[model samples]
Target: MVEAVMLWNEPNNLSHWDFKIDPDWKKFAEMAIAAGKAIRSVNPELPIVLGGISPIDPNFIQLMGSHGILNAVDVVAIHGFPLDWNHWNVNEWPAKVDEIRAVTKLPVWISEVGASSFGAEEVQLFGLQRMSELLLGNVERIHWYSLFDLPASWTATTRHKEAEGSAYYRHYYMGLLREDETPKMAAAEFPEGLGICQWFHYEDHRLDSAVEWLHRLKVRYLRTGVSWADSHRENAELWFDRQMKALEPFNTTLTLCFTPEHLGIAPHYTSPPKDPNTFAEFAQWAVSRYAPAPVRTNSAYAMPEEMAAPSVLR
Candidate 1:
């Protein structure tokens, strides 16, 4: 079951969003606002999260706030990759969260933060130690990037793969487990009670094992996605049902994003949709299906309105 709804994934990043087409993020705010409202209409107590901002930029969050986007969300989130991708040091995490907090009253979340085992497994081990120390109580949530590495044969999703050089290749090594599901050294040190960011592809075979790992890790929260693009494929509902069912044991934050090829302004998945409401419709459908509001009956066991209000993590 979904504990919260995260509107999109890194709208400011070229890898996840086409900023060239909607340079001001006006379209992104519009779609997010609409989706947030739709989600509320379905489940008023469900918290709506503004997707985790990559690069952890305060100016981008300020810009989204200017468009009244922050008003729609109950929490704001950010993603960081200090060891591999970001220029900032790993110790600056508190300052980073402070910068975002100064701009908004909503609780902040470290939605994605990880160290890749690309060069040596020791780097990931050290990163996990430092990350847990710097981030444990600094934010509301910390979802490690993934449970399994991206298979080397599969392309890493990025706007400029060739331009990123070695940095782009690190994507495959960000996982706690290798592509063959062997645990990296860092996996043993993963802090308990923190979440995991493990996106499941359509009909992914790793879902069961992934859940087993989460159980072993004693993780209570999860951050995953239901691609809008994948929703257009055959047997999509069957796959979605199976995926969500398997994940029912944890408190999940469902990220509703990715433009369908047919709905995008351009042919690519990163392109903005021609009609932003199309994305809103998809968000509404997912929430209504996966985390619908409880039916009001004449029973006396219903939660009071105040008690039903959305919780920060749940």
Candidate 2:
């Protein structure tokens, strides 16, 4: 049984992709409400989280609330990126979380928060520590953006072409560790009780080292993904078995995200499934295979039927 489900991640920050429609708040709120209702119907006890909007925008929460999004979900989430996107001042984060809480009158979560090592590792470490201290009591949870930096080759291959020319390139170094799996200063200084977001595509041999590092950091919660495309590929079950085996020793709570690919959707991975039944079936298989004590699927575009399908709960 999954503990909580976040509908999407950073929906307000669509600058990284080229979307077919104008990314408006109204549409986003409507989608969130529908997805929340569906998730609640399937697992009445599970928490339904509104995806974090980026750059600490309180007005977005207000806009979503106006559309009844506040009533649809149990938690309001926000990304705490105090260093990037011209938000250099770290002092503003507490007030930002407070602002959102005031509007939504719900538990606030800093779902995606981290400072990239764009300038210096020490600077990134300092910013991360300060942000954690400030956010300690203000929010329900804080998940660091990443655990390992994306390998340059992996970034080049996976990122959309438009991302190549922008500041998005800096994301390659956002992890607490470099691509080679060595720890950075931020890894050592990561506050206790906070969660981390790690990429799910690590090689088999690398899992032990990754777990070792996570153990050293005293990490308790791990947010990772299960890709629909990967599951359908050759030898998929074998691959998942290995990953799960590697992860078992750590005994960390898992938040497994479901990411199904839809062909016609722009930017590849961000699109919702055209066939809800197929997506629900795939989600069921993933849940049964991992049987993660708590699973979390990500998407703002998930249809209500897709979430409520009997296949998803079984």
* Candidate with the greatest TM-score versus the true structure: 1
Q: What is the lDDT of residue 118 in candidate 2?
A: 77
Off by over 4 Å in 1: 298-314
Q: Cα lDDT of model 1 overall? A: 0.87
Q: What C-alpha lDDT values do all the predictions have? A: 0.87, 0.63
* Deviating ranges (above 4 Å) for candidate 2: 15-22, 25-34, 156-166, 202-205, 228-267, 272-314
lDDT of 2 at 103: 76
What's the CA error at residue 180 for candidate 1, in Å?
A: 0.9
Best lDDT goes to which candidate? 1
What TM-scores do the predictions have? 0.93, 0.75
Supply the global lDDT for candidate 2. 0.63
Clash pairs detected, candidate 2: 2-294, 2-295
